[model samples]
Target: MTELLANHVCGRWQAGTGPGSVLRDPVRGSALVRVDATGLDLPAAFDYARETGGAALRALSYAQRAKLLADAAGVLQAGRDAYYAISTANSGTVKSDTAVDVDGAIYTLGQYARWGAALGDARHLADGEAVALARDGVFQSRHIQVPARGVALFINAFNFPAWGLWEKAAPALLSGVPVIVKPATATAWLTQRMVRDVVEAGIVPPGALSVICGSAAGLMDQLQPWDMVSFTGSAETAAAIRGHAAVARHAVRSNIEADSINSALLLPGHGPDSEAVRLLAREVAREMTVKSGQKCTAIRRVFVPGALYDAVAQAIGAQLAEVAVGDPRSEGVRMGSLVSREQYDSVQKGLAGLMAHTDVLHDGRRRALVDADPAVAACARPVLLGTRSPDAASLVHDMEVFGPVATLMPYRDLAHGLALARRGQGSLVASLYGEDPAALAAAAADLAASHGRVHVVTPEVGRTHTGHGNVMPQSQHGGPGRAGGGSELGGLRALDFYHRKAAVQASPAVLQALVPA
Candidate 1:
């Protein structure tokens, strides 16, 4: 019998009733573990999270809840070795790729802890200065935010099982909302192990952090009016989650991170030999191969000055050519297999669809794997596509292959480039590479309405700027429109999602007393 990974909820671990689903190793294509939630009671678990976990967390001040996050970070940091092993085995990620998920989660949690503690002993957040409702100072309305008396349900994507869990949970827990995580089944072991470690260490209050694995069949069916749901996956599934009764009728808040054909633009005057162009080429290659381009923020489109198109392609192709794809444990493997066979098939389908729309400037798919068998491993080499006709390449701007694939296109001018970037409709991030500060600023302003975050990388800051796909906790991680009109992780703003804001019309004295000093 395959080892069944247990679900942790209601202060204990329990296995599902049936044989359940088997999760295989993507690199070796061997059945490694099972995840089954057939007989677990979700409603009971939700109730416990609210009644027990939520109550305990809310009873403490923001500072106290923040300490819980800090302590949990310590616990996970101490057990990171196990997480790395599981990441390589189950997700087929290289050591550096695993660090992005594991270390990134640890850093984000610690960042939230520091920020939350700065809030002091406040139980609620003051939205703004109290506005006078009366001519005299006798009456006024003060908007304050209080932790909602509900639970947070996170349905995470496969590419970031570890970071996804903590990125959502850190803010939810800091805001005094208990969290129940449903990690994508393909990479549940890493997420499951992290949750178990935290729970066993008693880092979080009982029922404050729970994880459910296997089928997500009835998970959305268990939401309440006071609850919140945060999902990271396809736009189709995001739509279904949005229309679910919990959200449509009961008014449950939902944060959806759907399809985003994120772009990177090279500002005018940066020739292929310029430092700006060199930086863009290196960053593009890094984003494409990192996690095999499974990241939502990974660059899917490249918009460069029309004159420098070929040079840019050659530079990026050269960088991508150096990457080795195989089993992560192999000595020289820099890229690993996709999370599962399903992802491999999906990327291939998406790649084929886009290939018909663009020219394959550089094809690494034919390259041999380092130590992995073609039939057993789900490895994918980086492929760069290009098109001379930007106006007609609708699929290039619309489709996201979600693998080590990216399409490069030429734009006439800076304005034209910004317009081309906006063709993505909306995106989580759009980076601008240039030496001209004025041009960079102008292009950034133009793209702001269509993108959630703009990463401006100049030659001066090339070494210091965070990479394109790296989602920092200080900046918001979501975007508008097709990218999913969701907002998260803008420092204290993240806590707003788990909090309910209300305007209290009361006496001046009472209004002042409602907020922390």
Candidate 2:
């Protein structure tokens, strides 16, 4: 019998006693692990985090908490090799892709650790200078940020198990709140392992962190007014969580980052021969194959000038053609399989929906495997579809094929490209490629309304610029409308989500006492 993954509740690890959910390897379709959370006390887990964990964390100052985070990062960094091995079998990601999640998590923790310096020894953060509330200066009003007295429940997505857990946990811990992570069941093994590692390191207090390896039954019902629920997944799930009676009635603070049809645009003046055009093609192909396009920030829409549409399509197709998809552990395999058969089917369904309004340009459905059997593996080819009339192809803009699939559309000019990008309702990111800085600037200004972040690719920055899908710790990572209307990872701003700000109005002496020294 396969060993069931354990759930970390309170301060100890316990194996789930209920029937298990089989987690399969994406490359070989073999059962890797069994996950179950039956017989687990959901409310008791939260209570442990809030009372035991929260007390321990809250007893420390902001700087002390920050140092703990730094120490935890060191421990995880040392275990990178072990993490990569797990990711290869569980998530079907190439070594480089795994580095992005594993290393990215460590880097985010380090960044938060350094950011805590600005927070100083203050237990609570003062917002700004005091303002006179009355005619006399003796009476004034001030705002201060203090950590919530409740636990933070993080419901993460499957694409980034490690990064998702740490990114949210780092800030919550630093802000003096304990974290209870509910990783997506499909990829919970990696998350469970990481939590175990953190626990064994003894860097954090016992109940400071916990993991629910199976269903999140009765989890939301345990949320109090001061508690927070941070979620990342589909828009449909986000909406349902937001509407939950516990959240709506008690007004629990909830943050969400949902699926987005992110786009990369090629400016009109940048013809086929331009470096900007080549760069755009390269970026589009990279985003498509990276992690098999499971990323929510991946470019699902490609908008090119009407005159250069064919050129862009040919360039991207050629680039994608060279990509070898198969077992992630095999040599020379650039891309891997979808996370599971269910995800494979979801991608096919999304592809069929886009094909309803467009024609296939590069069919990724049939491809030569590197070292794995396609029949058993949950693999899909990187499909590139094209539509001449983007405005008429509502499905092309609205639907997101969450695999190695993207649509090539033609726009009349910059305005048309911006309009077409907005047709996704909203997105986490959008990229514009061109040599003309003025043109790129203008396009970015217009697209800013609909996108959380804009990537401007020029001849100079193209060489040094990070790829379009990469999210930095210094920048915000959420969008409006269809994209969840929440902000995350914007330097010190991220701490705001974990902490509550309140206005303190009183006499100068009383206000001074309220403010952190």
Candidate 3:
């Protein structure tokens, strides 16, 4: 097996102190890589980032830091082919699907770079002249932007390892803070490869970046007042990290993006024969199968009008039937296995719980594999469970399978459908299908309280739609409550985490003296 070593401190790579961990190819069920992360010195890694790396990064202006991010993006883009090749081993994704995550990062970095360049050298800006109280003709207060004198610790999830890392990377780096990433063990190899490519590019400072492949032992122990921590994973995990005593005592910034039970609403305007209905059907199936439906924003609950339940179910069922499951590297194969047998088993357990709560409308093939080795069990099907009273709130809210599984609940009417969609307390995203402007507006306003992102799926956009489950770099990716009340990506909003906004109380003439011209 190919060995994946732990990359720590700045520009340093090492072998683990304990026996290595083997990562298997989900499709072939053969070992693909062995990762070593034992004896990984978390304290040293954290110190290197804070003391050495943070100084190098913070010394540069935001514009210079953004340029570094842009240059790194170019280097990473040149190596995109290699990233895709490595990702296939994990399975359940197409080249296009991978691009959405990988390319999205590049796009985000590029955008942040431009934003920083626009900041110029202005530290304090005069909103307007305020009347003075201390002295006659004297003014006070100006908005000033200052970089935090600390490091950003990124704890990423396994599903979208690249995107998760970049979502925080662009914002924090552009805001003039160094980043230390701790990728999920399951997919840390891919992240390590990316990190290696960046380091070799020589665009970033020596200590501006670091990676840890194993447990974050003393990393949290070394956090300081201005340090920032961002995590993308389960709610429980995010909560634990937020509650870290060291982090709390130091008043470090903590951002959490957790997995949530998101939903999609189907409005009443679209007829069975309408193009919009067909498009929504395809979108639903795609979300169920894409990434083996391992995405945090995947449509966990799908709501349809009671009169159109059968039509929606039939359309999605037919679309899912054509999905070929086998090795992703093979031609004509649309879907692949989960990250591992352990993940497959976990999906099954979640599906069992979902099955108990609702009736199955379109249950995907689970008994046997279709195209791959018969001995090997593939990931479960694109499930469509049916619920009678979706508006009841207790039936379908907050239920998520985190796999190629979703529920289709029939609503009494348009108003009822919106209410059903809001049943999920808070979500990363929710998709709506229909052409009725009034209905769409009402639904969006009602569900806005629960969902962090909303997608209006229509025929015009659906024909060229990228699907409902995708997350972009410019938009906020996290949700409220169940989705971890943390925000990621929102342009400058993300950068605020790595920066501290300070109000400077001084005369315009004094500010002018502080910043010439």
Candidate 4:
């Protein structure tokens, strides 16, 4: 029998009482481990986290909690090699792709640690200077941000089990809040292992961080009115979470990262040989091929000048041609399989729907899998679809394939391109590529209303430009509308989600004493 990945709840590792669901290696289709959280006392877990873990964490100064986060990062970094192996077997990621998830998690944690330390020993943050309420200036009102007295529940997606866990945990822990992580069952191994390592390291208070795998049933029901939940997954599931009693009736705070069809736009003036066109093609291809394009921020839409459509497609297609899809351990395999057979079928179904409104620019679905059988291996090849008339194809504008797939659409000019990009309704990011500063800025500004981040790439940036899909900790990672109006990871702004802000109206002396001097 495969060993069940135990759930860490109520400050202890507890095994499920029933036969568990099996997690398999995507490439070999072999069972890797089992996970089941059934029969665990979730209400007790939530209470323990809120009463014990939350109290212990909230008692620490911001600087102390920051040090704890740094220690946790070190624990993960020390065992990084083991994470890489798990990513390969369970996440179906190549070495480079695995590094993005594992290393990215470590980097985010360290960044938060550094920032949290700068906040000093303050347990609560003054929003700004106190405002005088009386002419004598004796009475004043001060706004402050304090750690929530409740727990944080993270419902993560499978594409980035490692990064997703830490990106949210870093801020939550630094803000002196306990977090319970429910990573996607498909790729929970890495999350479970990382949490185990950190907990055993004794870096954090017991119950400060917990991992519950398998069923998410009754998890949301465990949330209290003051507790919060950060979810990343399909929009449908996000809706269900929002409607749950804890959020709908009890007013439990929620942040959601749902379906986003992010885009990359080439300024109208950029011709086929222009740097803008080259940059857009390169970045879009990278986004599609990276992690086999399972990223939430991956570029799903490409907008270019009408005259440059064929050139853009051909350029992106040529680069994607070099990619070899197969087992991650296989030498020369540039890409690996989807996280599971279910994801494989979902992508295929989405691809078929997209094909109805567009023509195939580069079809790799027929590409041979390297060192793996096509029947069981859940691999997919990079595919680019082009639609000349994007306005008519409403599905192309809004649908997110969520795999190594993208749609190319040609626009009349920059204005037309902006209009089409906005048709995405809302997105996590949109990149503008052009040498004309004015044109790039205008396009970026226009896209900004809908996108959380606008990536501007000019020839001057050259190789220095971070890829369009790289969700840096320095910038915001969520978007409005269909992208799920959730804000995350904008440096210190991330701490806001884990905190509760209030305006305290009191005497000047009392207000002054409430926060750090």
- List residue ranges in candidate 3 displaced over 4 A: 121-137, 366-371, 374-378, 391-395, 464-466, 513-517
lDDT of each: 0.93, 0.89, 0.75, 0.92
lDDT of 2 by residue, 153-196 (tens): 99999999999899899889999999999999988988999888
Which ten-residue region of model 3 has the weakest summed lDDT?
A: 122-131
Using all chains and alpha carbons, the TM-scores for the candidates as numbered come to 0.99, 0.98, 0.93, 0.99
lDDT of 4 at 207: 77
Question: Which sections of candidate 2 miss by over 4 Å?
Answer: none
Candidate with maximal lDDT: 1
* lDDT (10s digit) by residue, model 3, range 316-386: 88888888766777787777777777777888888787677788887666534545673554455577787
- Estimate, for each residue in 282-368, the C-alpha lDDT of model 4 and write its tens digit: 899899999999999999999988998899999999989989999999999999999999999999999999999899999897789
**Worst lDDT window (10 residues) for model 2?**
364-373
lDDT, model 2: 0.89
| Winner of 1 and 2 under TM-score | 1
Give residue 262's lDDT in candidate 3 (0 to 100): 81
- How much is the lDDT of residue 349 in candidate 1? 96
